[model samples]
Target: MGYYTQAARDVWTLLIELQPQTGDSGGGISRDEYISQVARDIQSKLPEVFDLDVIRKKLGLEISPTSVVLLQELERFNKLTLRMIRSLAELQRALAGEVGMSSELDEVARALFNGQIPVIWRKLAPDTLKSLGNWMIHFKRRHEQYSSWVDEGEPCVMWLSGLHIPESYLTALVQATCRKNGWPLDHSTLYTQVTHYRSEDEVKERPGQGCFVSGLYLEGADWDIEKGCLVRSKPRVLVSQLPILKIIPIEARRLKLQNTLRTPVYTTSMRRNAMGVGLVFEADLFTTKHISHWVLQGVMYGGRAIDSFDRRILTVYMDEYLGDFIFDTFQPFHFFHSDSGGGISRDEYISQVARDIQSKLPEVFDLDVIHKKWGLEISPTSVYCYESWNALTNSPSG
Candidate 1:
């Protein structure tokens, strides 16, 4: 069998075993039992000799343990899993109706219940953690990102979306620049300069100043490669992938703004409602258009799928869309397969849904009615329903 095939099978089996159930009878288990199963799985994955320092000393390689990527990655994974095990244990205890539950534990439980990923220290986006299939996909993406970094070794262009704490990396970049140039760390601040490279592979070397980062999605605007500046999004494109970005540390005193828009960067499309979430940073994007153009469009950068448009339309006009729906009355099986005897791809499905919603909207409400009744002012000419739907459902990494 192929390597990834075997890995997928292993994870699929674990997910089946991790299914949440209630009572002590049949092939069922409670939520705490599910947590216990995950804890045990994590324990099994951990190595007995995960401490690299001790391993290095014991192996008589203390002078230089090589600092291999595999070794470092293993150690990092071990630490992460160890913390997860501990947190899962605490959560399991709290699930048993135990008294005196800490606020953190309460938050964790609520996050899990609401289908959101939960970090012991902070809240993650509603990434469908309660849905094991979705969680598996999320886990695979994170693992792939980490493996890519490990294989590449201190990437020239980092994938910002793959990080759990992107601010930490951003801060570290400033710190490294400050330390290298002997500048006071406190006096340094970050300034982003967007590059023209479409992909990370195009970046051959690191900049002398800070770092190059990728995997940030731009909403409500697009970067014109030839012009090297922000422009209005394409006719049918709602979110556009930003090219490699040069994030440099500058002396706070020297920092100046000219013809740039201070764009907010959010961790996820859910915006502020997600736990422990807000604008992670404000990037100064080069723009020829007036800043108000983007501000009026609610333009921003996001870590993952940019779903603000989706939420506004989907949640508010849900009744209207559902009422006029001509498609098959939602069946789980129909989702994966098309009635035309061909399997529907994920993008195809998203497009189909978006088009269906788009077709129905004008029949029921025009731009004026929509804006007046719902207080949501969408562009009258905007026909990027596909992009909006993709942002809400299946935005592939950029």
Candidate 2:
């Protein structure tokens, strides 16, 4: 079947299985009762789809002990599914008036519907889901890439962003490099080199030294295709698509940092909660000027692709001067219809976001700090600000 056909079938099966039974359907069940029944069904059946026993057997083909990392990631996925089930049950109870709804539970439901990994599972910074349809595409592509790696063995060029646990893949690369060179694995670190090819399909074979990886994005900066170096971000362009890169293991001391920015790379665009886990590694990007220039511009790298709106928000957050007035005039979006009672006040919303941002980066400043740093806060108020924010946050992206 075609990709869309298969996806539609899958989603249709899920909806049919989870559909509510009304009085006309012979169950005579209320909405709350239907939700409770669906929750129980999810708890029972969803986990079977994520069973790792079968996956473990497939990965066991690689007899190397390094396979443990991949196994652990599979285990993590199973655990996350369990957590999702429990959260759903909580939501069902809240809907039945047995308990109160919470922000966390609401977030879990949103993540599930949008086909994005929940923050509780990934422990990464919370991000805009954009739209259900857009994220489903990313989710499907991720699974396709992962299944190809598992079924066909390692590929000549890998889509690095597709893995559930990218750190495991990087570790495997390091181990293979060390074994090939007869070097101590503990003494080596990852090193990245940009390739001339802009796409993964251009490379037909695996490299002798390291693996070729694709699917990385440059935030707050752009890559100069001709110069093959870091450059200022194009006006109104939020992110730059990076070319294929080769990652190899090298001696720690052998690594050079002179005239290079040790750019921290994340698995996603949201970097706040990704310090230890979601942060894959640091890649050195060649720069002509001082490193502070990149830092002030908030130049960074991420593995996954974000929609245009997310790119715009990242730019606004990074460079206050770009959209001070626009950002100041905006309002927070209310996602839940039944729960949007008066909604959160603008100041309260800012404080909540500041707390979240501060928890991730204690040393840096918060959103309010952006206004102070730029000394620019224009309020071109709009009557439709709230509606505009909601539309931007939830609209489907291409």
Candidate 3:
């Protein structure tokens, strides 16, 4: 076995029994504190022979000394495992020159390494993270412009939650890469399949081989988890395989977006089609008055997610979009209102108009625009006031 795990009962037992009982156990809390201090005192009584300074200078690890019997047993098993792997590789490589060597090598390699890695971290590339951040900055600024048609009333926030494994997290990463770097094939296509093939590891109704695999194999990318083969046996993809998907470069390079370097993995994900559906929400026949026509096209910018296993990466991107959506949603067109000819004051109305112009049309952010366009010759405090006022009952008509 590559790794060992204690049974649930054994683990629970360990959790309950932390410390051993000793003689002279009286005043419980005071006794416990004294015991901890005494333990520390005992620990501090290290022999002068093993100086930490010298140890650090000479040692790479804090290895404990072992008896002859245990040392021999450990060394014996380690050598046996090492020899087993070397022998397995040799067997596979010897069969390399034969036909279908990739398949054979895959079989042997799986029989060897799957036992080694029992836990998968499911880590993301550092470059992917950086690119995603940059893409978000760009998306938010662009969405603000998209929000031009809507009124800024509330925050556009969407609540999403889920777990992301290795295979499916690719979709959001690819979409961010595309939108920021500007790729083709439409936004939704980022989650769709580019190239796919069925290997022996798949568990499905139609166990098609190679490119002749079933529709699901071509549906989207997968992480090749430990649960493949319908028997809960081993991971699907082998280390030797070059994976499966290959990107069409001419089409990928068609757009030539600026600042492509910001998102390093954008092209890589596109090439390998590492992307897929991240998250989705649905309502039974939910209709909105704003949408006039529903045209079903190839791939839409914000249509629907085809592969939503969890809330994972969807919210990371959608948070910004939804934020802008909510900000723009439910806004009254005639929001900037005040009593005419001063029941309250002429100054308050001018300030209201100034704020309306500032938020509604941010292009006129300049103080000069405030002075010129709205004709509001007021203090700078008028530029950004969040408060709304009630029109006074009494009117002062000139």
Candidate 4:
């Protein structure tokens, strides 16, 4: 009823039904971990019990049985049922990897547990089979868009990778973005094109000074309030003409660390029911100065904010409780893994990042020549050296 599949909803009902949740159960385990418990007990063990009292006390069930089972038949199921339970748990674990992907999990469950397909698929709809097949369709297309941008040398980076808008709304937006960014995808991880984009329509200089995501994110341009199309305009700038982000810092604008995370953030391209068909048009409703402490780091490690917008996406907590559940179940997490390359030494990479920064924000004696690129009015100073932007902004004239 809430933003989940019927089966997923049942899993919630069943957990409370099977055992009153202790704080440990609620706080410690994730949805995937909790699902393992459901597969083991409620899925494999619940059906084995025929005793009315056992069902009532253990499973919290009150269903009346239609027929009585003989002792021999009951004995057959009662024996080695633990093995079956263990096996089901293993299956759920195997499925966990596939299901960890927010968009793909539903299709994985639907395929692996589709009753006839894997024989393991049971009538355990109560355990939340979660055949939200449509969600996967949506993300794959979004993934295509992601692959295109990241390959085209302009990765569609985001800071809060945890944000998963309600499935319906995300799908709608993904649909729109895919059409807009119809560039081809290149999956090779060997090399990435780090071009500079001045705006959505302007991408000049291949292997440009820095990587920039074209088009600033319109502060509140994209949304879904009671069913409407998404709106994307230029992201709000800190200054009138400058593209400096009010939300994200200048250092973060550097392309190198654009998608870097402080936590083991989940990153995946997912969508919901994308036939690659038509667009959903929504009504347009129109709608912070803060220097980030990490600006110097961003200048050194981050790319130029030549054209990119903030990677923050706002979500409406439809219900605080359900909203948390939606994020947990839909966002796929990945471990951080990077190996040192033989060609590009760490120092070399850092140097390249610095060079890229220099290229984008070259020095000019006259602020009147500013149309060339954005730079501090003071001196030809590398942003990496300036610890505080306040010091730079408060040049002698100010």
Off by over 4 Å in 2: 1-51, 58-62, 78-132, 273-277, 300-398
Instruction: Judging by lDDT against the true structure, name the best candidate.
Output: 2
lDDT string, candidate 2, 80-151, tens digits: 556666787788777777888798865555445334455674552123333434543554565465456556
Query: Lowest summed lDDT over 10 consecutive residues: which window, candidate 1?
Result: 326-335
Off by over 4 Å in 4: 1-131, 142-207, 214-398
| Highest TM-score against the true fold, candidate | 2
Model 4: residue 284 alpha-carbon error in angstroms: 28
- Lowest summed lDDT window (length 10), candidate 3: 292-301
Query: 1-398, model 4: which lDDT tens digit per residue?
Result: 11233356557645644553232345477544554554554453233433434423532343211011122223333332333454455557565664244333343333333211222322221121223243333323333433343235223332111112212222333333333445222211111222222233443333222122221222222322223222232354221111211111112122242222221001221111234212211111211101121121121112332211211111221222122333224244332212233456667777888999988995534433442355546454533434244456668963
- Please tell me which model should have the higher lDDT, number 1 or number 3: 1
lDDT of each: 0.61, 0.62, 0.29, 0.31
How does residue 170 of candidate 1 score in lDDT? Answer: 79
Which pairs of residues clash in candidate 3, taking residues 3 or more apart in a chain or in different chains? Answer: 156-322, 156-323, 156-326, 162-311, 170-275, 171-275, 171-276
For model 4 the TM-score comes to 0.18
TM-score of each: 0.49, 0.53, 0.16, 0.18
User: Which ten-residue region of model 4 has the weakest summed lDDT?
Assistant: 263-272
Tell me model 2's lDDT, rounded to 2 decimals: 0.62
TM-score of 3: 0.16
After superposition, the stretches of candidate 1 with alpha carbons farther than 4 Å from their true spots are 1-135, 145-152, 273-276, 300-398
lDDT of 3 by residue, 1-398 (tens): 11111244346445534433333345555433443343333234311221334323443463322112222322333343344344344444444433344554443333222211111111211112122224334323323422321233111210011111222223333444455456652523321211234342332222121111111211111223232211111254211221222221123334343211111122111112224332221111111211111111101113343222222244334343233343234443332223453465558778888998878863323444445765647555554431111122223541
Candidates 2 and 4 compared by TM-score, better number: 2
